[model samples]
Target chain A: MNVVIGIDIGGTKTKIGLVDEKGKCHIKTFFRTREFPDLDDYLDKIKSVSDELVENLDKKVTILGCGIGAPNASSKKGTIENASNLVWKGSVPILEKLKERMNIPMRIMNDASAAALGEMLFGGGKKMTDFIVITLGTGFGAGIVANGQLIDGYDGFAGELGHVDMTIGDGRLTGLGVRGGLEAYVSATGLKRTIMYMLSKYLVVSKFRGISYNDLHGEDITKAAEEGDIIAQRAFDYTAKMMAQALANFTAFTQPEAFILMGGLTNSGKWIMEPLESYFNEYLLEVYKGKVKLLESSMDGKTAAICGAAALIWENEKS
Target chain B: MNVVIGIDIGGTKTKIGLVDEKGKCHIKTFFRTREFPDLDDYLDKIKSVSDELVENLDKKVTILGCGIGAPNASSKKGTIENASNLVWKGSVPILEKLKERMNIPMRIMNDASAAALGEMLFGGGKKMTDFIVITLGTGFGAGIVANGQLIDGYDGFAGELGHVDMTIGDGRLTGLGVRGGLEAYVSATGLKRTIMYMLSKYLVVSKFRGISYNDLHGEDITKAAEEGDIIAQRAFDYTAKMMAQALANFTAFTQPEAFILMGGLTNSGKWIMEPLESYFNEYLLEVYKGKVKLLESSMDGKTAAICGAAALIWENEKS
Candidate 1:
């Protein structure tokens, strides 16, 4: 059996796992990402941890290589470039530094792109050659797989569906300073903003009227909507409408076989999925109607990142 | 030398040519497309024209195969399905019918998709592995190439950039009965409509003031803009703005190496190109700044369709 080390670098914590070819994680561990302020320190910790995991394995397995997924990572350059959430500034030559420590091959890519590979290798997109995976966490991210290959684009910055402008004018501004961006209204933060905006406008609102902006979360809104709260229900509807329109536009471009929704917001389940499917079909062109399927990601959230990172290495090896 | 028969089927006329592997047309001819309402009649005409062209070739050459470009073509099924512009009503089994007669291999794809392949093989996109070609004719059409392959999608309707809805409210209706589509604002017909709408709204106008809606043409607006007509300039500006925004949205998705503009509208030159490039950059995300290039198709308009059709066969052979 052959195994690969998978590392997922998040804003707060970094996950490490030993993943086999069958998409199974044999061992997993984590460390606080912020603790290592310097890039060299972080790389050293990763190497030590990986060595310990490899030494403990009883089976005679060859460790092939390492795959790392991080925010704003570039697969073309093997660098993490100007990621806002991370303490590192400028482009970090992650692959080169890791290569200096280990004689094995390595690969790096954007976290979302890795997740998309994970979906294709081990999750809902196994049979789908062309599809999109959208991650709705604190911010919105997307991964596009076309013709059974990930589209790294010319600069490895493709699949920024979250930054696609959806509003006509005077729309909400995203953290990226762009107004009317899909992420401003489709992510967990976007859902909260919608509920707050609705409460301010509609007098028919109920329990969410008094809640402060900081205190409200996506789960709160989902809970309220589940209990038949009109305002909460409307917020979910609004989010779904925006998402559907964006998906419609995406369908025109790539015409993927399916769209896999992942991360926190998907927990709302039927409330978001139902309207999303309806509006997506309604807004889609006549030819594209009933052709694309909307799906949910099947990877467990806690381990999905690691699986995706491992899958990246497996995908490269197979290709 | 090796040659292939290339046929470009249009609503009004059908272009036939004998093209070499180097993207040069040796002999070419045409016939009215709508004259033969029946599929069999049209196929017969195509066979005769192709045979005549092949017979007249001066140099000794081996005929490889045949490639056809038509509206609503499906490469997967080798059929043209529900093409509104064509006289044929339903699906036409173009490849099969032609193959049965010629005893040679043949392929068929949408006209726009053929154009993209042509650009890739012999025109502006020869060096590009990933790019999009937008054809701004009476109706808008697009063909996308990703990772050196045309994205035919699951249903062969992958590149429908023209039908992407741009307006939030009541927008100009397309022939497909859809409103606010990109085609409604960027094509020649769309340009004339914009000029007419401007004349109706703004009191300060020029030569176009006296012209009725039916008599006005896209060239009239281009001529007036050249002579310092404010309304015409604004119309051009408006069209560029809408096209730029749409291109920006497309950039976020495919992140193509460049966007190649073809057809009648591009003749406006810098009047359209300058603003398009400016606004495309403006709307693009910071990471994508100065990354994507906007270009004009270098192929002659009259010969491009034939070149594209021929290139399709070459692309198939090479792959």
Candidate 2:
């Protein structure tokens, strides 16, 4: 079995794992990503940890490939372009740096794209040829799979569905200067704003009071929703409607077999999924109605991204 | 060189032509399409005309391929499924029927998709691997190309850019029950409605003073705009802005190489093109600004659809 090492870099934490050809993951570990001031120091820690894992292995397994999943990691450019959340302000040659440390072939792709690869190889989309993987976390991200292949456009920058204009007319303003996008209404950060706006419009009581915007998480809102908080429920409802519209627009672009939901907010389960399903059907073109299916991601948290990166390496080996 | 016959079936007119591997077209002819009630009669005429063209060939053109472009044509199912404009009330086996008359293989696709393939292989997209073909006729239709291949989703029903929602809030009812779609505002029929809405809102005079809704065409308005009519200019400006927003959303999904404009309304040239270019740039993402080029279709009139159909056959042969 050809074993590949997978790494997932995130703003909060970084995860490393060793995966074999059968899609089994082992030797998983996590560390704080904010500790390092520069890329070299971060990579040194990665190499040291990987060295510790392989030192005592029986028969000394050879690493066939390495794949890293990070924000703005581009497959065509072979670099991680300036990520918004990351402290770095310029493109990072991660794949090139990793190549010198390990003599194996290495690849890099955006986290959402990697997640799509993971889903296609071993998760929910294993049996499907066309589908979309939507990550509704701090920000919304999408990966499009059509004709049994990940749609990496001319510059390997396809599947940017968060920016798809979901609202018409004087739409909600996007941070990118465009108005009314899926990200502005459906993302974790967007949901909090929705809740705040609803609070101002109507009187509401909460378990906690006087908190910073950065302190608000999707879990806190969902918890309040579970406790029969009307404001929280309304926030989720609006998000579901907005997300469904965006998905409907996506369906118009590519009639996917299903839409697989991932990331932190998907944990809300029925609160989001039920209404999304209803609104999706309501907004879908007649021919597409009752045809496309919806499902939640099988992989959870950082594991999905790590698994996806390993899958990319496995795919490269086979190809 | 393998020569193929292409047929473009429209509500009012049908075009037929012989096309070689090099995109050279000959034996072109056109006739009224609605004269026959049954498709079999139409096929009979096509057979006679095609037979006459191939009669005196030195070598038997036994390997002649055929490709048909029709409204609502499904590339995957090989049928024209209930086009309202056409008299046919059900799915028409366009490819199968054509194959029965010829010894060689044949295929069929929606006219817009055929146009996209034609543009990719023979027109503005000849040097492009990723581009979108937007057909500006009775209704706005788009065909998407990604990763150097046409994107036909699970049901072969992708690239429905026209139906993408551009309107937000109330007072908008879509054919799909969704509010504010690009087709709702930018189609040729939609343009006429826009003109009528402007007339009700502002004072205007026109040669089309007595023209009925059904009688109003994109050409009449194009001529009026050329003659320095304010109402006509306003209608084009409004439609162009709506189209630009749609294109911006398209770019978000797939950063295409270029957008190739085709069909009847694009014949208006600068009146439509100038406003469209400015609006597209206005709405484009900062990263993608000035990256996507817009070009007019190299194919003209009936030949555009014929060439598109032939291009499909040629592509299938090479594959």
Candidate 3:
């Protein structure tokens, strides 16, 4: 069985796993991302852990390829363009650096795009020829798969659905040189902003009050909604509506088979799912109304990225 | 050389042509669409015209295929769903009917889609893999080609760029369910409406006042614009701005090599092109900025449908 290393790099943690041609994952490893002073150090730590695992095995395994998923990884440039979370400031040549270190073929793509490929190759969208994978996390991200291929557009920035102006939300500052975008209202910050707006509007008090958005986390909001918190429910509802509108607009151009929602924030489950499903259907054109299935990511937490990044190698081999 | 019979059925006219493998169109024919009372009559007229053309040729030119481009033609369903402009009242099984009559394989697609295929096979996009063809004629229309193949979406309803919202003009009604679409502000009706608005706002003469908009045409507006009419020029500018915004949104999804503008309205040249080129650049995301080109379609007032529809047969042979 041809096996490949799948690495997922995130702001808080990093996940590494071995995925085979059958899309099955083997022993997995995790580490805090902050410990490494630089990207090279981080890569070295990953290599050391992998080498140890390979040595411990009863027989030497044949590693065919490597696939990495990072926040701003560019498939066209084979680089990780300045991710706000990572230590790297500018365009970091990830694929080339990894190739030099490891004597195997390596491919890198954006995490959301990797998730899309994972869904396409092994998960919910396996039977689908066209679909979109939306990551409802820190920022709403999208990976578009059209006609059985990922759309990288002209500069590999084709699936930037989050930045499409669904409605100019309260002007919020961001590094991408825009104050308001669809991401501002539907992402994690958008959820926090919604909570604050509802609290101000309804004059409500909450246990999660006074916590910075980053500290509160998506799960906390989910917990609040599950506990029947009116403000939290409202926040989820608002996000779902905006999300539906954005998806509806997107459907106008590329009608897909399904929209797979991923990331930590969508863990809110029914609070977000039910409303998004209802509104997305409501706004969809008659032809597309019942056609698109809304699905949860098959990969969860570290496993999601692991499977997604791993699937990249599986796909590269086939293509 | 393999050849196919290509037919474009429109509201008032039908265009028929014989297209060979090399995209060479021979012996073009045209007739009033209303001359036929039923589908059989239309097919008979096509057969007679086609028979007359091929009879004189020394080679026994067996028509290898038949391709049709019509409004609301569903490539997936092999039918032309009832178009409001056509005399037909319900879904017409055009492909199957034509195939049986000609004893040849047949395919049908929406006019814009056929135009996109035409551009891919024979027009400005002949040398390119991915491009969008926007037909600015009686209605706002588009055909998108990505990854060297036409994007039919899930239900064969992709590339509806004309239906995207217009930010500059009064929310105009469109044939599609959506209001304020690009069609409302950029097509023939859109141009007339803009002229009417200008007349009310700027023109004081009764000669250009209180006339039903249906009475005015794109030619009249073009003549006015050519004569340096301020209101007419502003109308063109407004149309260009709205179109540019729509194109910007489209580029967000599939970054094509260029946006090829076709159809009647595009004939206005600089009046439409200048604003569109400027605004498209201004609104584009940083990554796609200055990357996508805007070009005029070579198939103007010609058998674009014939060329594109013929391409279907030619494409099948090559594959």
Candidate 4:
């Protein structure tokens, strides 16, 4: 009857779940993060939701610990620091404040890394010792696992693959101001940008021509590409090429057995995955050729966030 | 007394040292490697040198085990696989054959990774849990240490930073056939190549115009730059720029406390170091700007190889 609270905090919404050791969420609750911009109000809401979830349970159960996954979070500091996407601007000591409200032991980490640990414990990476989990959403994030353990070096800031200084790009800047960075070419935002750029460069007709920059999505591109749109096909090709280069370089760093990818960008399906595999092999060093594999995520986005959060507690507790 | 045999194999010569647990080389000997094209003869010479080091000892000593560091070596397979620099053509099972010849326990690893373990045990990285060691002699190599352990992923080929795909350069290719690789612009041979390329592209007059490509060395460039030669200074500046870009990318991957550099390129002094520091800081992500330091290798090249090899066995034995 033991359970842990897993919280996945987004910029707009926060999802909370009561999870068991096998990564199943028995019950779920949520609150709007933007609605409670005040720190006290936000903390109060989080406390109320957590308390209500435990209180409403019909059967007796033991609450073990709490795990939180959020943007710009540091496991060492137990806080989220300068998370641009979050309503809370500066460092928020979520772990300390949450522990004060609930007596359970709590741990916090960057969402990407939490997902990686989840993959390690329950996903396709269960049997692998060294691998990287890439999240290609509004931005690109990576969770690096080496020597069979999750690595969060120097205050949980390692494996920021999105911000890696890059050369293959259309001179667009990353959210961090790195020109031609990997994220500038591979993220969901990057896909929209690519389609826009390709439309301007090519003389061919396409469905994406009139759409504004932010209005375009990966799903639209996928549908158009399936219907035989050359511009859409070209965008996926270009994005895959840059991602392949980044993955190829990552191979030299960790020499991972495989690269497991997640996020909205994966929805592009065969358009990106096929080229990613081919280009990845082409760019790999001779020693690593025909060895490293590009894999799809076994968990969906929402399930990954919640399950990964829960796994963080179980992963540490078991070890 | 108790000791271990540390063998550091090179393309031209091989060094054999009888090292104690404290990392002191009690007795050292050597034999020509390129001189013995036959694998059997090379193995015999290595056996004789190791035997001589033990027999010639003035005091009674217990030989515990053996550790070897060599090019293209795989610790898992215990073989030197297709090393272009060595006379042996295919996979030479040095570990198996050496075990048959001597009957003592032995371990083998790549020289660069061995130097990293050497640093973790006896040099600047001793107190650090995460760091990278960069060897920039005739070519570039890297030893990555994370979670206070040396990492050699899947067949001992993980830390090949020299072969990381690069974006900056004057169209130079690495020995591994990688174009614009990090090694193409950061080693002794890199310096030579840079000077030649600059002389061809620029109209600047300098002291290096007449020298043949094979005759050039890092020392000559260091001397010329010290004497205020413009092209020499430019070569160092360009090399430092590319190297800094690489180190910045490495920081994002490992988030190491520092980068410890060894080999001939460090001798370039302020010419490279000053620019390297500035460029690295400028290129780093905002969170990691001031956190990573560039440190000189505390152990010399020869000491690093032997001591690191000895430390390999001692490290495993202690743990």
Write out fnat for all predictions, comma-separated.
0.62, 0.76, 0.52, 0.59
Per-prediction interface RMSD in Å: 1.2, 1.6, 2.7, 1.8
Residue lDDT tens for model 2, A1-319? 4578888888888888887776677667878888986888888888887777666445457788888888877788888876777766687888888777777888888888888998988789989988999988878888889888888766767777777776655566655555776787888878988887777776877643465567877898889889998888888898898888788878988789999999878988888988999988988877678979998987756577888888888887766
Positional deviation of residue A22's Cα in model 4 after best superposition, in angstroms = 1.3
> After superposition, which runs of candidate 4 have C-alpha atoms over 4 Å from their true positions?
A56-59, A168-170, B168-170
Between candidates 1 and 2, the one scoring higher on TM-score is 1
Clashing pairs in 2: A168-B166, B166-B180
In CAPRI terms, model 4 is classed as: medium
Q: Which stretches of candidate 1 lie over 4 Å from their true place?
A: A55-61
Off by over 4 Å in 3: A32-37, A56-60, A82-85, A168-175, A197-216, B35-37, B56-60, B165-170, B197-211
> How badly does each model clash, as a count of residue pairs?
0, 2, 0, 0
- TM-scores of all predicted structures: 0.96, 0.93, 0.91, 0.97
Worst 10 residues of 2 chain B by lDDT: B168-177
Q: Candidate 1: TM-score? A: 0.96
User: Candidate 1's residue-wise lDDT over B130-211, tens digit each?
Assistant: 8999998888899998888788887787888888888754689877767888888999888988988888889995888888
Worst 10 residues of 4 chain B by lDDT: B163-172
How many Å off is the CA of B47 in candidate 3?
2.9
Q: Candidate 1: deviation at residue B97, Å? A: 2.7
lDDT of 3 by residue, A204-237 (tens): 7666566765676777888988888787888899
Name the better of 3 and 4 by DockQ. 4
lDDT of 2 by residue, B1-319 (tens): 4678888888888888888776777667877888877888888888877777666444455446888888778888988877768987787886778667776778888788888888887777878888999987777788888878888888777877677766645534444454676776777777888888777777777655567778888888999998988888988998888888888888877788788888777887888899999999987776677788888887766587888888888997777
Task: Give me the overall lDDT of model 2.
Answer: 0.80
Worst 10 residues of 2 chain A by lDDT: A169-178
